[model samples]
Target chain A: MRLKGFRLLTIITALVLSNNLLAQSIDDVLNRGQVHGNFGMDMQYYQVDSLIGASETPDEDVLMNGFANFIYTNGSFSAGFRYESYMNALQGFPAQYKGNGIGYRFASYTNDDMTVTVGNYYEQFGNGLIFRTYEALGGLGYDNSMDGMRINYKLRDGLFVKGIIGTQRLYFEQGDGVLRGVDGELMVNDFFGGSLKNSKTKLTLGASFISKYQADQSSQYNLPENVGAYSGRFLLRHRKISFNGEYAYKINDPSADNGFIYKEGTAFYAETAYSTKGFGLTLSAKGNDNMSFRSDRAAGQQDLLINYLPALTRQHTYNLLATLYPYATQPNGEMAFQGELVYKLKKKSFLGGKYGTGILVNYSTIYNIDSTAVPTAENDSTRMGYTTNIFSVGDERYYDEINVEITKKFSKKLKGIFTYSNMVFNQAVIQGKNPKKYPDVYADIAVIDLTYKINKKNAIRTEIQGLFTQQDQQEWATILIEYSFSPHWFVAIMDQYNYGNTNKDVDGNFNERIHYYFASAGYVRGANRFQVGYGRQRAGIFCIGGICRTVPAANGLTLSITSSF
Target chain B: MKKLILLSILTTLSFTIFSQQEKRAMPSVNVTDMEGGTVNTSEFNNDGKPMIVNFWATWCSPCKRELNNIADVYDDWVEETGVKLIAISIDDARNAGKVAPYVNGKGWEYEVYIDSNQDLKRALNVNNVPHTFLLNGKGEIVWQHNSYQEGDEDTLYEAVKALAAGKELKH
Candidate 1:
C-alpha cells in the first residue's frame, strides 16, 4: 500500500511537470505553430415498422458513428491523425466497419519547391478518370485512402510533377494490390517566362500514368498481373471562352464488375464554355467503354474503386425529385452529353423588376454505347467478350433530365426562387434491380421557395414542392418551413406525403399512402453546432457528387454534433 | 468505457487550450481557378485588409441561400469595411463546369475559385459546405463558423468591423 501510494504521487508530479513544459513549448511556437481539429457524431435510435418496409431494426436499438481529426502544423512541417468509431455503424453503412480504429494518419513537410508526404493520403490525377483516392462520408460512406509515400515537385513556376506509390484502403484494412502512378502538368505560356504569360490566350497540358499489380489467384481465367492506364489532358482559355479535353486508355483488365471480361478500356471527356456579362453557356460530352478499374479484382459495388466516372445528370435539390430517381454512372460503357445556359435580365426592366432576374436552363442525357456480343464455343469463356464502337450510341436510354430555374427579388424583405424539372429515369438499369418489377419512371417536379426577413435578426423560409409521375408511387407533395433566430438558433419542420398510389393489392385496394414527417432544431456557437431530429425516413437511393448508396426505410430519433477548432 | 472517458477528458482539455491560444495563420494549399489554372492560397493577400473565405457547392440549398443573402448587402459591406469575399466551390468534375455560369447568372461580385478535388477543403479541415472563415489584416484566421442561419452575416460583418477598428474580439 505504501509503494502504491508513492507511485501515484510520482505519477501526479510527473504529469504536472509535463503539463507546464507543454504550455511553455506552445507559447514558444505560438506565432508559427498551430493546432486544429474537428469532430462529428451521428447517433440514432431505431424502431421497427412493417407498414413502410422498415423491418430491419437492429437488436441493440441504438447505434452511433463518429470521427475526429486532430492536426498540428508548424512552419512547413505538419502531422495529423483521424480516429473513427462506428459502434456497429449506422443501418445503411457497410457491416465491415464494426469497431474503432485510426483510419487516417499522415506526416508531411515542404522544403523550397518540393513537398513529401508519408502514410495515409488522398490524391487525384486529371479529372479523376485515371486515378483518385478520396473520402465522401456524408450521405454515402465512401472512403478509399492510400497508405504509402507521395512526392510533389515544382520544377518551375508553371511546371509540376507528382509521384505516388501505395496500397489503397479496403474498409479497415489495406487491399492486396499495389499501386504506382506519376503525373506532370505544365503551363505553356508560363514556361516561356516573360511576355507570353501576358498573352490573351492560356494553354495548359497534363499527362498521367498509373499501374496496379495484384497476383493472379483466380482458378478459372488467367489474369494479367499488372494493368496500366494512361491519360492526357489539355486546356485552352482565351478571354471569356475555355475548352478542356482529356482522353484515357487502359490495357485489358479482368474484374468482377465486368464479369471477368478481358477488354481494353477507353474514355474521353470534353467541355467548352463561354461566359460574358449577362449570358453564359457550357457544353460537355463524354464517352466511356469498360472503364471499371479497382484495386481488388474481385471487389464489387462501391469498394476499392481506383477511378471515378462522373454521372452526366442534373443533381436535383428538391426533396421528392432528388430521392425518387437518382442515377449512377454505368462504368461498363456509356455516352453522355450535357448543356447549360445562364442568363440575367437587367434590373429596372419589365421582367427584372427592381432586382435583376436570374435564369438557368440545363439539359443532360446518358445512353449505352453500341456493343455486339462475340460468339463463343460451349464452355469456352476465354475471349475478348465483345466489341464496342466509340461514337455509336445505343437505343437504351439510362437517364435524362431537363431543368429550368428562375430567381427574383420581389421586394427589400422578400425573395423567391422557382424551379421545374422533367426527368426520364430507368431505375432497373441504374439500380441493378429487376427491370420487369420496377418499370421506367417519368417524372415532373416543380418547386417554389420563398424567404421573408422580418428584421435584421429574424427570418422565415418556406418551400412547396410537388412531383407528378405516372409510374412508381404516382405523386408526391412536400412542404417545409424553417425559422431562424439569427447567428445561434434555427428550427425546421418538413412533411412529405405520397398522395397518389396507383398500384392495387390482391383485394383490389390501393397501396399504402403514407407521410414521412421530420422536425429538427439546431444550435450553433462559434465553430460548433448541435442538431437533433426525429423522423420517419423513406427508403430510397441517397447520392452526393454522383456516388450513390441505398438507404433503408427507418423510424428513428437522430442526433448530430460537429465542432472544429 | 475507458475510451469514452479519455475522449471526454481530451475534449475538455482541447477546448481550454484552444481558447487560450493565439490566432493562427492560414495554410498554403493549391486550388484551381475557373479557367483550370492552379493558384496557391498563400498568395491570397489583400494588402492588409480583411477577407472572408466561403466554401460552397452547386447542389447545396443552404449554401446558395447564404450567398444570396450576403450578395444583397455585399456592396454596402465592402464600402464600409474594405472587405473582400472569396467564394470557393467544392464541386467535383461532374458539376464544376456549371460554377462559372451559375455565378454569372446570379450577378455576384465576389471572386470565385474551384476546389474540384477538395484539396483546400481538406487542408482547412472543412467538413461541410456553407462554412465561412474570417481573416484579419495579417492573414491570421481570426474566426470561423459552421453552417448558416438567416442573419449570420450580420455577426460576420460585425467581426470584420471590429477587426478594422483594431479591437480584440471576445470570441
Candidate 2:
C-alpha cells in the first residue's frame, strides 16, 4: 500500500508539472496548479456509559479525525488525492479507518464531446437504483470508488453514453468482486431536430446494466458463478407534469445473511409530480424485497453499497422523538407510498393578509408483503426465479406518517411557521433488530418557529417543539434561540428535555429521561468561514441529504474552519 | 465573568460596524460566448433591453418550467424591451451533450453556454439550483431572486422596465 501511494503521488506530481507548463504562468506558481484543501480536527473526549453496555469503554480519551484534499485543475486536465487519519476515529465512522493513507486518488480529462477518467471515480445511474458512488458526507458513508477507468461518449445530438469497469473499494482494500456497467441516455427532442424541438411534450429514456463477478467461496454452496443485474428508466415531461420510474432485477446469490442459499430479488420505484404558479404536488410508490444490493454482500454499511434504495418517508432532523421512530427502507418484503402537496396563498387573501402564506401537507406509508404463499417444498430445488405474482399487493402496514405545515410572514422581518404531524413507525425494520419485542406505535408531533428582527443589525429566531407518544418514552420538548447579523456572524442555542419517561430506576429516578443542550456560533467573511460549538448530544438517528446513520451520544466541544484560496 | 461580558460587547460592536460597511462585491469577467467570442460584462449594456440570465441544470425540474414559461413569452419580451436572455448550463460532460439539443428541442430563443467546470457558479456564489440574477442596463445588479414562482418573471420584467426608464424600483 505504501509503494502504491508513492506511485500515485509521483503521477500526480508529474501531471501537475506538465499541465502547468502547458498553460501561461500567472505567477511564480503557475495558475495551472490550483490547489485546494480542507483541514480540521474534531477532537472529542468521551465519558463511558459507566453502567450498562460498558464492556468496551475506554477510561478517558480524546478522539481526533481529519482529512485534506488537494486538486490541480487546468483546462481539461485535472488530478487530485485525499489524505485522511483518524486517531480513535468517531464511534460510528468505521474503526479500521485509523490508518493514514491516500483514501481517494483520481485523475481525469474532458473536452466538449468526450471525457475520460482513470484511477478513482464516482458515478451514479438514474436515481441510483442500479449504481451510485461517493459519500453523502454527513449522513451516509458509502464512498465506493472504482480502482480502474471510466469513459463517456457524446453521440450525435442528445445521445450520451457512459461506461465503467473496475473493482469496487472496501475501505483501504479492494473488494473480492469486480463490477462493470454501461449507461445510455437519449433526449427525445434532440434526435428529430426543429419540429420536435417545438413540441410542448418532451421525453427522456435511459438504460443501465451492471454485472458482478465474484469467485466462489467454500462457505457458500451452489453460488451463481456470474451474477448480473439490469435496470431501465424513462422520464416524461409535459407542461406542468413529469414522471419517472426505474425497475431492477438481480440473479440469485447466496450470503451468510440469507442463510447461504440463492434467492432472486427485484425492485421497482416510480414518482410523478406536477407544479404551476403557486402549488406543487407529488405522488410516489416503491416495492422492494430481498434486494439489499451491495457490491460486497458480506460487508455491512462499510463502503460497499452499489445501489441506493430511496426511503419513501420524510426525514426529520429534530432531536428527541423525531428520530425515536424514524422509518428505514426494509429491503425485505415491503411496499410503500408517499404523497405531498404545497400551496402558497395569494398576497391579498383573508388568510394571506399582506405578505402571503404557504401551506404544505405530506403523507407516507410502508407495508409488508405476505411471502408464506410460496411453496416451501419447491424453494430449495426450483430455479424459476423465486416465483412472484406479477401485480400482487401486500396488506400489512409497516410505517406511515402525515404532516402539515403553515407559514406566514406577518411583516418583512417577523415571520413564523406552525406544523403538526402524526406518525406510525415499525422499529423492527428501522433498528435492524427489535430490542423490545413489541413494535413501536403511533405518535403526535407539533412545532412552532418564529423570527423577529429587532433592528437592521440584530435579529432573533426561536423554535418550540413537542412530541407525544405512548410507547418507550413519552413526551419531549425542545427550545431553540438564534441571533444573527447579516454578512458576518450568528449564534444559536438549543436544549431538549425528555420530561416524560415511563421507566424509573431503583432509586425511583426516570431512567429513560435525558437532557441535552448545545450552543454554537458561526462567522463568515468572504470564502472563509468558522463555526464552533459545545454541549452534550443525545444519540439519535441523523439523516442529512437523504442518507441516514445512527450517531452515538457524546459530551464534547467541536471547532471547524473552512477556507479557499 | 465581567471580562467575558466586555468581550462579547466588543464582538457585537465590531460586527455592527462590519455590517454597516457591507457593499455588494462584484467581479469583472470576460466569458466566452456560445459562438466562441469573448463578451465582457462591464461593456455589455441592456440599453432599455430586459435581459434574463438563467442558471440551470438538465436534471432540475423547476428550472425547466422557468425556461418553458419564459419561452412562451420570449417573443413578446423581445418585442417589448428588446430583452436578450441567456441560459447557462452547469451539466458536466456526462450530460453535456444534452444541453444544446435540449434547448433546441424546447425551441427557446435564449442564448446558452456550458459552464461544465462551474467557475461561473463559484464566482456568483450559486449554492443552490434554479438561482436567477437580474441585472439592469447600467450593468449593476439591481435585483436577484433565489428559486422561482410561476409568475416571478413578470415581476422581474416590471423591475427591468422601471430600471431601464431611470425610475426607482418599488421592491
Candidate 3:
C-alpha cells in the first residue's frame, strides 16, 4: 500500500511539472478567476418485488442524481472540474455511488492542426469495437474514461494521426492496468486536388492499433507482458449508397473469464446502406470469437473496457419486449446478420393513393461459430489458445427475428401503421442462462397504431399490440391512448395484460396472469417541461444498439422534468 | 416555369422564417487571450463576427482529425468569408496543464477556449463531447454537427461560408 501511494504521488508530481513547464501563462493564471457552471437533476422512483437477490422492498422514494460543472478557460489554457452528487441514484445504479465530490477535472489546449490534453477524458475509435469511452447515462455505465495524456497531429492534405496513453479510471481511482492506442486516417474527399471532386464518389481509410498491459497475477496465471490489438476500417459513400467495414485482431492474454491462459481473438463488422428519396435499405453482419478484451483481464464490469462492439439488432422501445429477452453480444464465437428495408409507395396508384403509403421490413439472426479448444499437456494444466474449424458452423441458430410494418395516411387528419413480427428466441443463450430454457419457437407479435389530428393544435394517438408465446411466458396484450395539444399539453394511458403463461400453481391452474396500467401527463412551456406517470412496469428486455439489459418487473410512479435557461 | 418560380418563392419564405428563429439559450463567458486580453462572448455578436465554436478533447481521435481537416481549409475560409473559430478544450486540470505546450508543438492557428467545468456543454445540451456549434454574426446558432468522419468538414465549411454570405441553407 505504501508503494502504491508513492507511485501515485510520483505520477501526479510528474504530471503537474509537465503542465507547468510547458506553455507558462502568467496572464492566464492571474486573470482566470472567473467561475461558470452547469447543473442538472434526475430523479427516479422504483418499487420491485424481486431485484437480483435483494429482498422485496415495498419502499417508495425518489433517487436523485445531479452534477455541477465549473470551468475556467484562459487563452490556449483552461482548467475545470465537475461536482457530482447522487443521493440514492436511479434504480440499477451501483449502491456504493451515493456521495458528492469532484468527479472529474482537466486542463486542455488546441491549435489549428495540433491539440494536446492531459487529464481524465472520454474518447472512441471507429465503432468502438476496440476502444470507446463515454458515459452512457441511460445504460448506467461509463465504461472507459482515462486519466492520461493525448497528442494529435495533422499532416499534409487529409492525413491525420492521434495517440493516447493512460490509466483508465475506475470509479474515483485509476484501473490496475494500462491502456494505450494510436490511430491514423486519410480522407479522400478530393483525393489530391480537385479533378476528382466532381466525381460522385468519396472514400475514407483508417487504421488503429491498441494495446493493454496488466501486471500478472501469479495466483491466477502467468500472463503475457503485453497483449496487443489492431483494427482497420474502410468507408465508401456514393450519392445513394454508403458502406463501412472493420476488422480487428488481438493477441492472446488470458484471464479468469476464459480460464487462465490467453486465447487469440478476432472480430469483423460490415454494413451497407442505400437510400434514395423515400426508399432506404441497410444490411449489416458481424462475426466474433473470444474477442472480449479489457485492460484489466481479471476485472469484469469494474475495470476499463478498451473497446465496444455495437450490436446490430434494432433497439425495440416497446416496454414488454424490451424487458424480457434483450439480446447481449456474445463476444465469443458468434455470427450475426441484420437487414432492413424501408420504402415509401408512390402516390395515386392502388395501395399508394393520394396519401402516400410506406412499408418497412427487417430481419436479424445470430448463430454460433463452431470452435475447438486446444488440449493442454498433463503437466501444464492451463487453457491457452484454441483452433477454429474453417468449415463448421453451429448446428442450431441462437436467435432469429423477422418483422414488417405498413404505414398509410388515410386522410389529411389521420395516419395509421400496422406491424407484424415473428421471432425464434433462444432463452438459454439470450435470456435465462438455464439450459432447460431452450429455444422458444413461433413467438408472434402484432401491433396497430393510429393517429388522428383534430387540428394543428390538437392530436390523438392510439396503439394496440398483442404477443403470443407459448414457451415461457403467456399471451400478452397492450393498449395505449395518448392525447396531445401541440404547443403544450399531453396525456397518455396504457395497460398491459398477461393472459398466457405456461407456469402452473399447486392447484394445476396456469400461472395467475397479471395486468399493469399507467397514466401520464405533461405540460411543456418552452424549454421547461415536467412529466409524471403512475403504474406498474412489467418485466422486459431493454436494448440499445445490440446491447441489452433486463429490466425487472416493478410497480411505481415515474416522474421526469427538464428545465433550460 | 411558373410552378418552379412558385416553389422557389416558397422555399425562400421558409428559409426566411427559419433564419428569424431565436437561437438556443446559453450562458455567457469571458476568455482571456494568450497576451492577457479578455474576450467576452457577449461582445462576439456585436462585433459582427461569425464564431465557429468546436468542443473537443485531446483524447478524442475524431476531434483531432476534425481540427486537422478544418485547418487545411481554414485559411481559405478566413480569406473568403472572414470567419473565426474557437476550439474549446474540455480536458480537466489533471491533463489540462499539458494542453498549451501540446498545441504549441502542433502549431495550430485557431483561438482556443478552455471549458473545464463544461459551462458551455450544459448550456448547449451537449449529450456528447466533440459536438460543434456554429453561431452567426448575431450569435444565433446556425448549424451544428455531432460526430466526425474523414470528409465531414466539407459539409461544415459549406454551411459556414453560406451563412457568412447571408444565404440560408436549403435543408
Per-candidate TM-score, first chain only?
Answer: 0.92, 0.88, 0.84
N/CA/C clash count, model 1: 0
Interface RMSD of each: 8.0, 16.3, 22.0
Q: Evaluate chain B of model 2: give its TM-score.
A: 0.75
Give a tens-digit lDDT track for model 2, residues A34-117.
444444344566545533343354554666555666666555566777676667676556666666778777887777757788
* Weakest ten-residue segment in model 2 chain B by summed lDDT: B20-29
Q: Tell me the TM-score of candidate 2's A chain.
A: 0.88
Residue lDDT tens for model 3, B1-171: 455445545554444444432344233443433221224454554267577888776445346546744764689988887888888776542223223433442345788766554445644555444566777777766666554433446666777788888887553
Which is superior by TM-score, 2 or 3?
Answer: 2
A249-272, model 1: which lDDT tens digit per residue?
A: 999998888877777999989999
DockQ of each: 0.33, 0.04, 0.03
Q: Give the CAPRI rating of model 2.
A: incorrect
State the local distance difference test value for candidate 2. 0.63
Alpha carbon lDDT of residue B166, candidate 1?
A: 80
Error of 2 at A366 (Å): 0.8
Residues forming the 10-long window of minimal summed lDDT in candidate 2 chain A: A542-551
**Structural similarity to truth (TM-score) of each candidate:** 0.91, 0.73, 0.71
lDDT for A308 in candidate 1 is 87
